[model samples]
Target chain A: MNNFLTHIGRYILLMRLVFKQPEKKSIYFRQILIEIEHLGLDSVGIVVFISIFMGAVLAIQMAFNLDTPLVPLYTIGYATRQSVVLEFSPTIISLILAGKVGSRISSEIGTMRVTEQIDALEIMGINPATYLIFPKIIAALFFNPILIMISIIVANMGGWLAGSLTGMVPSGEFIYGLKAFFEGYDVFYSLVKSVVFAFLIVSISGYHGYYTRGGALEVGEASTKGVVNSSIAIIIFNLILTNLLLA
Target chain B: MIEAIEISKSFGDNKVLDNVSVKFEAGRCNLVIGQSGSGKTVLMKCLVGLFEIDEGRGIFGEKVLSRMSFDEMKLVRQEIGMLFQGGALFDSMNVEQNVMFPLSMFTEQSIGERLERANFCLSRVNLENVNKLLPSELSGGMKKRVAIARAIAMNPRYLFCDEPNSGLDPHTANVIDNLIKEITEEYGITTVINTHDMNSVIEIGDRVSFIHEGKLWWQGDRDTILMSDNKELNNFVFATKLTRKIKGL
Candidate 1:
């Protein structure tokens, strides 16, 4: 219990020291460029692949379950809503981001730790956590929801195209279904979830990466821990948010 | 001047440094020499407040780090410059950026002024015309030079180097040693060096502290250290076959 408390206490110290660091505006442009370069571009292939598959899967599942054959539009409506707001947009995006952003944060930080770059910062009177992690957090916070939103639009389009040609659903109903189901909560819910998920992913990964010890093998371990922990935390937090916000 | 009194550190049940007290005089190289895992690194860290001592006091000039708050410690840290074993250059930054990092962080120097100072420090370390190059582009010796340039860019009152000559050829190592010695004297900075190299000891050490079994075992100058009849020091110095052949021991 005491060890666990101290673990939490270090983060508090980390936060205080992070706050005390001089404003990192000097590195802002470089940070943003690096983040977008890494988190967005490096993961586009995976994001696209995941989103397309998720959308198609959701459409097929909803179509199989629905009994509204006379008005098949309900199948498309249910698929669009659930996939966009509940699962594909937030949950799937979070998973993809975890695979993308989390690993990079871990490895970059782990390398820094191994090379004593973080220690160099500390001795120079710079806060390593602030210098290293803050820009990443900010980039993840700002860019993730945007990426999620893009993923949603692209995935829904994929689902519509895939469903129409394959006879999984009728074309007339698919377009009408999406138009008719206008849940105001879809955009808000997914955006909120994306933001919170970004924080969890960035912070946990950064922590794991920064404290990496040993050598190359240990850095690999830290990277694995980073992705696994972030993905699990994102899922767990998803349920908590859903219960709180939806209930 | 830096002084450590009764400094001790442990990892769980394993004691790393035990009741080690040492003082570093200003305007000279205070060398800490021991084989690997002799607690030299831990002792150096304890002196710098990088690692907290289990029981001891570290006085940088007059203010003791053990008793100071984070804010107060920050003030004392301003007087410190460190060259880590691996050079620890910020890879993302260019040579100029890495050297100017300290100035930009602690001082509100104008961009022009910071660049000028960085250029000057780099020249002082004999690193020239490589300001725009990344660390990856530099040779191992060049990287070490850049780290030294960064360390002294702040014109610190105190300097510390951990295994500064590690991984370098003897010739490059000697050059680095001479540069550190020259800077220490020129700036009158109290320099503390953690080294295991005998060449470094003979070349730069004005005062050498031998740490053995987590204790300060012996203290003296390079000339005296070489001539000491201490059995352990003799064994350490003559461990290699070549050294043994040279010493006829």
Candidate 2:
């Protein structure tokens, strides 16, 4: 418990350093663009591929269970839309990112720490935390919402395709259900969750990486811990945000 | 000059540096020599503020390090340059970008101006035609040269090197030693080097401080070091049979 609290304290201190005013805004902007390419843009393909399969599976399963006479044919589409928009696209997809982007951030920073590159930055009078981490946080915050939007669009199209091909539900009914009772606030809640998740993933992973000690073995350990911890945080916050925003 | 005044550091119960102090003068190569785990590297880290000293303080010219606020310390750090044992070049950036990093971050120079300055530093280190290569692609000697180029990019007043020749062949090591010496003299920078290599001491150590256990055991010039009567210093300075034979001791 003491060790955990110490880590918490250190993490808070690190965040304070990370958010300090950048030495040069132009350089920071360039770094943010680079991070967007590495962390956000590169992950698009995987996010799209995974979302399609998940949406198809959700639609099929909903159709399979809604076979009773009392349930409407459109209920399958409704359930798939709610699951994808409210939870699957935002929460499950973010968990996937916690594994992908989180590990990358941890290992990159951990390697920098071991190599003394971070120390070099400090010796050069540059704020190492602000220079190394702030750009990543900004890039993720800007691009993650767009990625989530893409995931939503592709996943719904996938559901539509699965319904037409599998004959699980009529295409007209699925489209009608998708358009029916559409609350814009659900999208807002999802975007909110994605932004929060983006911050958690980048900051938590960066914390693990920045404080990495020892060499190769320790860097690997930091990466693993980064992914696991960020995933857990995403799950916990998913529940909290759901309660706070929707309930 | 940069000075450490009775600085002490400990990790848990293991005291690494105990009230150690030394002064490094400008336009000279100040070498800190010791056996492995003798706290020489720790002392260097303390001087650079990488590791906070438990007692005493670092004095850079007229300024007291411990008395400075974070911004003041940062300003002091701008005048300092460091070369790590492994070169510590940014893995993702090419040589040119690595060398220009400080200028881009600290100065309002245009990219063209930064490039010209980076070119001059690289040329000063006698490194050319490798600007597009990554650190991993260069030979060990070349990497160290590139690191030197980057260190001098800011025209710093103080230069610190930790194990600058640790993994090089003797020939390459000698080349690096000469380069550091020339740069220190050319820039009139106070250069502090942490090294265990006796060759470095003989070739470039204008002033040598020997640490034993956790104490500052001895201090002298390179020539005086060979003739010192200190038992621990003698054991360290003439550890090899070849050195003993050369000294006819």
Q: Positional deviation of A64 in candidate 2, in angstroms?
A: 0.1
Give per-residue CA lDDT, model 2, range B47-148, as digits (tens): 888898899999989999988877888999999999999999999999999999999999999999999999999999998998899999999999999999
The regions of model 1 sitting more than 4 angstroms off are A1-16, A19-24, A28-33, A41-45, A67-71, B240-249
Tens digit of lDDT per residue, candidate 1, span A1-247?
9975785687667666555645456665577678876776666677777787777777776776774658455567556755676767888788878877888899989999999898888787666788788777877888888788878877787678767877877777777776675777868888889999998888888888888988999899999988998898899999998887777
lDDT leader: 2
User: How well does each candidate superpose onto the true structure, as a TM-score?
Assistant: 0.93, 0.99
Q: How many backbone clashes does candidate 1 have?
A: 0
Residue A134 in model 1: shift from native, Å?
1.6
TM score of chain A per candidate: 0.91, 0.99
* RMSD of candidates 1 onward, in order: 2.3, 1.0
Question: After superposition, which runs of candidate 2 have C-alpha atoms over 4 Å from their true positions?
Answer: B245-249
